[model samples]
Target: MTLDLSALPPRRGRLAARPPAVPPGPPGAPGLRRLGLDPERDGLVLLPDGPGPFPLVVMLHGAGGVADGAVRLIAAAAERHGAAILAPESRDPRSWDLVRGGRCGPDVAFLDRALAATFAWLPVRAERIALAGFSDGGSYALSLGLANGDLFAAVLAFSPGFVAPPDYVGSPLVVVTHGSEDAVLPVTSCGRRVAASLDHAGYRLAYHEFAGGHVVPPDLADAALAAFLAD
Candidate 1:
């Protein structure tokens, strides 16, 4: 068989597309459900109790696990702040796309679908939406949030390694947190480099270096949640 690489379509970043319109979930539906194209993976969406166009934080989990305890903690905090939290697993069970591949691939599509579902099912304050993640997921969030800044108003990256995007978009507010004692990703190489690049690019950032290892402190999570909800 003759090979014709040229016949294949070019590998390019896909523009965000709107998902099919659907009404909000049933009033008493379970908070977390298995929906969307990928049924094996599930996402958690917590809507505020009362009527509200609430702020939202779309979170991406670290490499290796499902949504972590910090995600649940953030959800609880968001509930108090009247904000909503949506956390989706990566298509690749092991790690996010940006961690394995440089730029976005199928993960971004999953995120777009999740975002669409979130908006359709909840009353979101579109102006206050933020994208947040930790570790490899943090790297992916930075890349995606930068590429789709018109949709994400802010980005919360915790201990991210690098931000690799084929293109750039609007300037969204950013917050980064890294532990000086982190051994998994290392503070000097990953966090500092990412923060410096974002700053050099003229993006607004609030960075914090704590005295811990590869863990998200409750206080730091609170700070990040505050940053995401700030006006």
Candidate 2:
């Protein structure tokens, strides 16, 4: 179903739709499928190998990255934990709207549509939804997750540069991972600063710094998913 932007609040970064009470039955078959929401830059969804009201993670791709690669980062871990993945392509070719415009706009709207479609097509646990991303995508995830915490129960940002939410909403659990030797966006100025800000804002945050470059380690990705799906 197409999302009605007018039905959503007039806020800069707010999403309107929530999970439906009685979702249309006959969920999609297990495996990956293109959302076909947009013709040029459609998104992708990966379902686990069993019938379940599985946990969901909405993943975002970094600048110049696509949904296909972003979904692969956590595909193995998600399969192991029986979670579903919804990776949406950004409206902008370079990065998310929030990163480019300093406020959420088209990307937010597209993501809302993507989530609405995913909820309708999958057996998802309403309370087990999380937002996660890498690099610029990570920053977008943090910003959008904070703005729509009512929808996302947790956020996992990998090597995010900053957090600039148009507005804050509910309080969701947050996990941030960064490399100490990140050349693109340094740890001290980026990840550390972001963690400090979240902590000062009284948000529950788990920050981890590793010795590497701008990349999400497999172990850390697994751990982040574990924390996100934990009871």
Candidate 3:
């Protein structure tokens, strides 16, 4: 089914003047799975013990990434910043639309639903919302976040490979982190290339290179979360 990704919650900034989202193909068409994700039920939504209106970080997992471990890894940092975590499972259990980009697919539709559900029932500060992810998810975050800049004021990409945005939208601030010793998606190629491109495009970007591999340290996650939740 084609989901209405329009009607995003209102925010305080002027959105970019971009056309509406068009399905590059059938909205829910399935493709071959390459990386495979662990079984995820709906999206794992984690909120602090109590809250009125909290910042929200829409987190995406790596390729075939574990849901429990992924959320547990970042939940503490997000909570420390009084932010809610909306961890949506890609419709595909293997990977995200990062392979192609957010043109049209079931994963994008699922994201539309996830955002709608979050805003409908959760206490989210629409203006403070962000799109973040790790590995493949991180790459996808860069693509989708830039495409929906008005909706997501900030974007946090951790150890990303590349970005594929079919079109561009409003300009949003971005925070990118990569492991200098990353073997899967090496920092020299993946992270550096993406960061350079985003910088060239004139988007407000913060790029960080750590001395590790394809992993998100708590400190890195905390830093990204803090920046995502900041004003």
Indicate whether candidate 1 or candidate 3 has the larger TM-score: 1
Q: Which digits, one per residue and each the tens of the lDDT, describe model 1 over residues 7-29?
A: 33323443353322443544343
Residue-by-residue lDDT tens digits, candidate 2, 56-137: 9999999989999999998988988899999999987899988887867788878888887777778788899999999999
Candidate achieving higher TM-score, 2 or 3:
2
Every candidate's lDDT: 0.74, 0.89, 0.72
Minimal lDDT window, size 10, model 2? 1-10
Best by lDDT: 2
Q: What is the TM-score ranking, best to worst?
A: 2, 1, 3
What's model 1's lDDT at 123?
A: 63
What TM-score would candidate 3 get against the native? Answer: 0.80
Please identify model 2 stretches exceeding 4 Å from their true place.
1-10
Candidate 3 Cα misplacement greater than 4 A, ranges:
1-41, 100-103
Question: For each candidate, what TM-score against the reference?
Answer: 0.85, 0.95, 0.80
Query: What's model 1's lDDT at 12?
Result: 43
Model 1 misplaced regions, further than 4 Å = 1-37, 68-70
